[model samples]
Target: MMKRARQDAMVENAAPQTSQENKKQKTCFYGSAFSESDPHGSIDWGSLPHHVILRIFQCLPLVDRARASSVCRRWNEVFHIPDLWRRFEFELNQPATSYLKSTHPDLIQQIIKRHADHLQYVSFKVDSSTESAEAACNILSQLVNCSIKTLGLISTAKPSFMNVSKAHFASALTVVFVNSKSLSSIKIDDTPVDDPSLKVLVANNSDTLKLLKMSSCPHVSPAGVLCVADQCHGLKELALNYYILSDELLLALSSEKHVDLEHLRIDVVSENPGQVEFHTIKKQSWDAFVKHSPKVNIVMYFFLYEDEFDAFFREETPVTHLYFGRAVSKAMLGRIGLNCPRLIELVVCANGLQPLDDELIQIAQRCKNLTAMGLGECEVTCRGFIEFVKVCGGRLTQLSIMEEVLIPDNDYSLDRLHLEVSKHLGRMWFPDMMPTWMQFDAKVTKTLQVKCGIYT
Candidate 1:
């Protein structure tokens, strides 16, 4: 009798509870006339602030941001801002043509038309194949009609691999030579153009050309570069790799009135007459460089091998940046200390490095103004880094140590040698493979801010 009474009460409690739950579910799903149901996971574009949305778009890479604008009507209206697309043409690794093809081709063409008068940076990759080359030339032709201040064309194919006519590319490039009054910088690599075409390009548009680079171009000879130097008086920065830039060209640049030669990088792979190898900077060449202009502040040394660097580093000339691929011996460092007082940055990346504790200490003492340094793939242990820090404790600002150099050890128990570097927290960057240090965020934030010129 007691069991039956309990069952009746339990049934009564369960019946009201189930009915109340159903009422709540109905209210949530079908909403009452007084209140609306929340649409979870749905995006409310009208509610989001304009500036916040634009900021989010700006955070994306140039290529991504371009695509994001095409997603909807609201995005299309926001992307028309001028400041957002000023340097949009020169985004690193940005293939504008492919993105245009993926989306509405006519839409991209319209954007280009609207900004042609203000476009400044144009970067594109071209192929040696006829069809792709034609497409590239067409895109370039559109940019040529604009005020493209900087143009970089990276062709991946070997020069010998393609024997196409200069007329194929030059016919389209002629528009740039004639109309691009604001074209200041040009970088062409892995493809060599004919000398006559190069001559015509420079002859027609040399006044506005400030920087020119041609790397891995076997056909563009020393005579072609001489023509460039003779014509382009406003040339400030020039980069050439494995091409002959003759002494006559240098002399012409030196003698030119109102010449603005600031940065010159000559990477010679072949022994071309009239063009001096970086390793063989003679007294006359050094004299000519100094006499030419006081504006040339940055010079780079890119030797083909360690033997080349060994032959080159004996120069007493001053340079702001030095890049070599080997361990710098104490004696060589001593020579650099004596000669390059204004050295601001150094990069060492090679297999042959036997870093001495004393040599690094000496560098810290000598190079007071050295702000940036890159030690790429050196076989440095934690103990070696400790020694490195002991010498460059207060002054070291930027340092890159690959993960392979870290000593294998357990946590909590610091090795005697590693302790020295591990304790002093300046700005430290670690490879992703390594274990995260305790002070990772603080160090990265501090370092990135300083590197980005935002000191606080």
Candidate 2:
């Protein structure tokens, strides 16, 4: 009986010890589960240097980037870094159709408000609607009192949306340009704009507006442009499309007041060639037009045909940068190339094979200062490229070739042909070459992806 009592006492002691061990194990299991649920407690994010985090935030979109900044004061400070602003400018120019618009309009507005003040350029295409003016107004209002260096807007609208009154839109635009003290460039698109609106836009901003692009504004005719030329005497570049221009207007543009005009582009919508009055571009007229301006470096136009080029060349006209589509023939190219020794850039569209190899060779030989050459649909072989490269050597900085020579499939594959072509072209541009057809064909890596609906 004594031994039985001792055994019972020992069993009870062992039972309590077993229960205590079980309780300790259960606590450990729950503790491990809780630790996994909170990864910040387990992961050492503080180990990563702060600058690396800022770089990570810099790579994000403006919205996510802002969020990363708000996560901590260190990030908030880095978000305001000047280099990050440059990256933002570069990212903004990247094809805009790659982004997803924010679901929350207020969130987008806040994001825009934060960076709009820091922006040097704002390029956006808004859908044409009654809402578009309001949206544009909203965006511009944020940019008010900011130093906007460049502004480009492309608007697309349904047929019905275009019927709105100009005055109504003008009021909204006036608000946009109110305090843009440092606004330097302005590009507005195809809309029925009135002169008063334009006057208002240029009133305060004209002193600094060096570049102006006007599209589909019918009232921005030769007279209106002359007015602009008088107002913005410092204008360096002017691009116009679908504007009604006449000889009288061209005469006004030829005024000595526009001696600072360095780049000029004009495109007319009228099919009536006589309406443009080609006489305005005659040699004696151009000589008078350019007499006062010695700094005029670049002039590009889509007008003028074969006879016009011949006339201009025969008159001993000098054009520094010349671009002639299939309109001018090979003979004309040779004539002009022979005449204009100062021609530094030449762009020719191989149309109708007017400029044969011999003509191109002559131009290459004469235009000694030629720095850039663009050949589009010009039936040039490896022979032309190689010969031109040999002649131009270091002088050739930019060369664009659009045609691909297909090698025979019998003894050579497409890859080999492309490689050979690239090898030849690469030697010409050295380290600063564009991807030859071969490298573009071989590259198959995609590290980033974006999905955006096409608006334009």
Candidate 3:
């Protein structure tokens, strides 16, 4: 009986030991479950050096960065790093488009709310819709404190972002102009940006601004542009419509204090076809402008009626790169040969069937520096072409003349003309030939035709 009592006591002691072992087993199981459930705790990616991780994140596109943020807690934290958000492009596309994917509004808001301070360079590109414009405005308005250095607003639509009311567009843009005091490059074409907004831009960014392109902003007058010219003497390049040009503005640009301008693009728009009276700059005025900035590139795009050519080249004009949108006349081309002494590039789309023999020869003789020429729907005899090539020589770096433009006269020999021009161009050309599929065929079609007694 005494041995049985001792045995029963031993059994009770062993039961407590068993309970302790079970508790240890439960603790081990819970630890492994926690490790599996908490992915960040299990993965070693978070242990990567912060800078290395940052570079990897930087290479990912803005859209992909948002997706990677949901991967784990550590990645979510990295997504918020300021460096990743410095240069952002807010591309807005319609709901169904193949060109680009539209940015989610919620994500845009998240960026503006959390990382707007990190933005330095920004661009907004939208398709043809008011909704997209309004979305852009919303983002711009939210950038009340953004100090961006470069800003570009582009519209891929027909009506363009300018379709938005002036008041609305200016209100949003003013927010940026008022805040971004360090802006250097600003491009706002076909927007409703006016003089008041321009004043704000100049007041804020005059010292830092280097390039400005505000073409098709009708509300901006000559005085408005002049204000910018006088205030922003550091501007290297400026593009605007012709109406914004005046003697005062040109004189301001020519001032010694103003840095020698590098590029000046003028878009000549004719809204009313019947209106014959258009603005004209004097010959001496251009001479003075060129004298101050000799190396300046003067680009002119003409969108005028055939009758409107009377005032354009009445006297020697200072146009370096000239493009004709209408069917130019021989007389106008003759005037160009005499007036455009500084012409370097010329593109003519259409002229009648009458061969431009004299005009081509005159241009070849006069425009010594002409390096590039493109002709379409025009005619030039083989003799005239050969003469043009002789005068211009191999220096014509860019020559785009259609096959139809070469007229066959008494001096016509396509093979001979091709040989001469090709030798100078250092390339092969069949001046009389047009491209078709049979040119590269492997079969000996000519031999076969001869064997069958067939002639082309």
- Output the TM-score of candidate 2: 0.59
lDDT string for model 3 (312-367, tens) is 77788778887765578999999999888888878776777889989988998999
Candidate number achieving the greatest lDDT relative to the actual structure: 3
State every prediction's TM-score relative to the real structure. Answer: 0.60, 0.59, 0.81
List runs of model 3 lying over 4 Å from the truth: 1-47, 96-100, 426-456
Worst 10 residues of 1 by lDDT: 28-37
Q: Which residues of candidate 1, in runs, are more than 4 Å off?
A: 1-120, 126-131, 141-146, 155-165, 242-256, 266-279, 287-303, 325-341, 356-368, 379-393, 403-456
Instruction: Report, for every candidate in turn, its global Cα lDDT versus the true structure.
Output: 0.58, 0.55, 0.79
RMSD of each: 10.5, 11.8, 13.9
Residue 225 shift from truth in candidate 3, angstroms: 0.7
Give, for candidate 2, the lowest lDDT window spanning 10 residues: 446-455
